[model samples]
Target: MSAGTPERTPTPGQPRRASVPEFGHGMVVGKFYPPHAGHHALIAAAAARCATVTVVVAPSRRESIPLDLRLDWLREVHADTPWVRFVGRYDDHPVDYADPAIWDAHCVVFREAVGPGPVDAVFSSEAYGAELAHRFDAVPVAVDPDRRTVPVSGTAVRADPAGSWRFLSPPVRAWFVRRVVVVGAESTGTTTMAAALAAHYGTSWVPEYGRELTAHKLARLRERSPGASVFDVRWDSDDFRAVVREQQAAEDAAARSSGPLLICDTDARATAVWEERYLGSASPQVRAAARRPALYLLTDDRGVPFDDDGLRDGEHLRSWMTERFRAELAGSGVPVVELTGSHTARLARAVEACDALLAAGWSLADPIATPHTN
Candidate 1:
């Protein structure tokens, strides 16, 4: 027996009833190109009206975000909706009705995705809702075709992910990794600032992966060779590549599961810095990934007390490293937000830059273009 109490079969040639929520079962079909807040709202509204709502994600081979990712994302966003089931088909199907065969194929796929059910109503915010509903012997409920209330779409997000970032949930945002990188020399508070900024925004953050590796290397050296202090190999090219790879891993993992704004303590670029420091050159992969973020927070060591964590090269190399970072940024064309003064002041300054980006609809394509600061 179906979970929804089945109604009697219609009389011969009689039309099946068309009321949606009033009939206990409802359904919604969407591509959810990237699954933004607007999609969530639509799902929420449908779930509210029906006793049980089965959401069928439109499948396609041409999508940049894969169908599985979309399905997983939908599951995460609607996890609390036990009454709402998510479904999808894996094959070469149409995301848009580009060809005549798509309509027939899609109808078949839709039915397959929503098998063994008497869905009373079909919900959508597009013109095709009526046709889709008609095919299923259900009523059509168009929620918001205009997109006024939740003014966002997958196309707009794909074009400018950073700009449309505010519309995306963490799962969607994670795929893009709109990085806000805090970087500078030793004792410049890069680690401290990244944590504070993440906390300020109530978001997740990527810690300094290189620093973690350095700790491990130091520990192993001590265990193998007693009283041996040097852990300089941590900055070697091969090891730096490891740092870059692991840093990328942490960043990748954090991006798919973090809030709208994902913060990075330091990024692959830092590996390039270590490369130059030890070997007078940078790794190819690390150098490539060293592109500027939505914002480059270059920390200034001036007037700030330099408290060396045993790994730091003391207050001596602070100025040199700061200059190296500046020189690195000099060519990237990325707008720099130079942070100075006490931690509190720097945090406030960073917030100013971040707030302006959010206000301007932070674009993932060119995050730092619309520069703002005091």
Candidate 2:
């Protein structure tokens, strides 16, 4: 299992890669926090040797990404491999492999998940694999414990996910989403630009949920009172605040389901503009939920037609709101991508911004701060 464990050696001159555990049924166990490329290589090494392999997905409560989401990533990566299967056990058990008491508890969990089996071999990249395999009555096969085969680690990926994007799976990459928010005054082609970017990138987009809610609420109000005008209805900051929460939830869910990048029609950063127009001032929750985007494309509403959707304050107010959004984003540390000219030109500019963002990634020395201010 380790350097001096009397294990079979790999082929001569190929020290980086390990030989497969030439056995019938192999087992691998790991927390698979984000299921990176190294995890995939480890599973593949086991799959190469055995007729079948069981991958136990162990997750603790303290993980930033939820257990279910991590499991989802594992399933997505290894599901198509005929020889690989997945099992899981989420518990608060200690992960201290060096401690005998902790190892005993882990053995009990592993025994239950593995069930009754000969367990021809146990595969891992840790020194503890020797003891774990001994408990299972199987030979321990260590695969690239030095991590030379796959250089990336889960901790490194978590720290600067965008910089280490190649190691992550598509599903897990969703968690490290470089959210690009297209926001500005109403009728400025925000929806169109967001959709175009998503389509270009072959990913999903988070539509403006607050606007959708506004349309729904207005429709119901009109249904109840047929001849009532906009002044007949009265709403408060609490209503918009609730909409911000919904928008945030929608964006989070979309991020889970989307690809490497998530395109947002608008996020909490723009909720202030809406709240200010209707409710005098923005809600505190809006600033709280606002996140720093990888890139913010502020639509100028230049040559675009200004049409009211029954909820807007008309074109006359669009310029002022645009200025307000610009002011709100001016001092924020997030990178801004100003869009002008035709729709095609705007889309091109947005695509260019995303390409640059993904290419450069976040520098360790400086990070854009998500300001929690009005």
Candidate 3:
């Protein structure tokens, strides 16, 4: 049942035999588009009954997510299930369930791909799938089409991504939530670096969640005190504290909504850094809002170009800014990987550092030294 062994072919004159459990093989086919809770339930159920489970992931044109992303989602969700094997539906074979010949051909290809083993059963959701399994001479284990018992489907999960994410198993949710929040200080290329990291890793990047919170707080303040100054409204009010909490929740929600990874432009810690530096001290609530990131990426101020975003203090003060932020972070005992060089060079270094950290079994919270390459 392991990946490399060859399957035994039945003799030409012999009858097709019912697969023996001793041979230890099973095949499960589904679209598995992002592999929601229902898919996991079915796979786990099937895996319990069989010695080996070959998951045939059929590509769907209607779904927006890429095939590889779906596969990664499956891998992340089923990391503990060593008996599970993954394979793509053959491109040469048609996906239509009505085509019995095509299904048979796909079965042959799957059997060959997994090495020669007697396939004892086929686990699926659709009626057409049951028919195809019968045609392949395997016992058809039909998963509930409505998934009413499991009560989660990929379509419904996709429709309300954030809300429906609670339906996923804990491991899947954890994997997703950790991949998003990329935190850094102002003028350290948080926005640029977030976008670049997302592109490099092929994942979604959430823009600064705090912007909306800030805007909302400003709006509420304007309503309360029409003539208040921008600083007075933002810095000297309870509204700022509310905005900080709101921003943190939004970032966590964004992480739960997407898979692969979500690169966040800034986090609550970045907001706190500015609040303390400019306002002398953050409000008690704002101070409480500042929390350590899953992975803290510190960028050195090597005089990278800065644009006037109305909020930027310009490149001249970057060294001072970097020093203050570094001191603030150091006191918290949170480890940081300081990225240096040109923007592109820094980004490349960050990626390498992250990869190495992950390879060495370090999670986001674990402190790791930033690697420097000549």
On lDDT, the leading prediction is 2
Please, what are the lDDT tens digits per residue for candidate 1 over residues 1-374? Answer: 00111122111121123344465888988777778777787787777778888888864565556778888988887777778889987545523544557667778888888888688989888777887788788989887678897777766776666656667775676676557888888888998998888888777789988788877888788787767554443456778888888888888788765655678887777668767887788968778776557778889988778885766654787898899888887777777889999889999999888777655553322111111100
Give lDDT tens digits, candidate 3, residues 145-240: 656766666555444333345455433443434343455545667778877877776545678755555556667777988874445544443545
Cα deviation of 49, candidate 2, in Å? 14
Candidate 3 off by > 4 Å: 1-40, 43-171, 179-185, 212-234, 237-239, 313-317, 360-374
Q: Write the residue-wise lDDT of candidate 2 on 1-374 in tens digits.
A: 00011111121121122254468788998777667878888888887778788888776665556667776777777766666788888756755656789778887887787777789899988777888899888999988888897777666665566545666665666666778899988799999999888888777788998777767777788899887655565678777778778887888877755656788888777987877887788877777777787778999977888786666654887788888889888867898888998999999999888888776643332111111100
Q: For candidate 3, what is the lDDT?
A: 0.59
lDDT of 2: 0.74
Off by over 4 Å in 1: 1-28, 31-33, 36-128, 135-170, 230-234, 362-374
TM-score of each: 0.64, 0.62, 0.48
Best by TM-score: 1
lDDT of each: 0.73, 0.74, 0.59
Total colliding residue pairs, candidate 2:
0
Model 2 weakest 10-residue run by lDDT: 1-10
* Candidate that beats the other on lDDT, 1 or 2, i.e. the better one: 2
TM-score of candidate 1 relative to the true fold:
0.64
Better of 2 and 3 by TM-score: 2
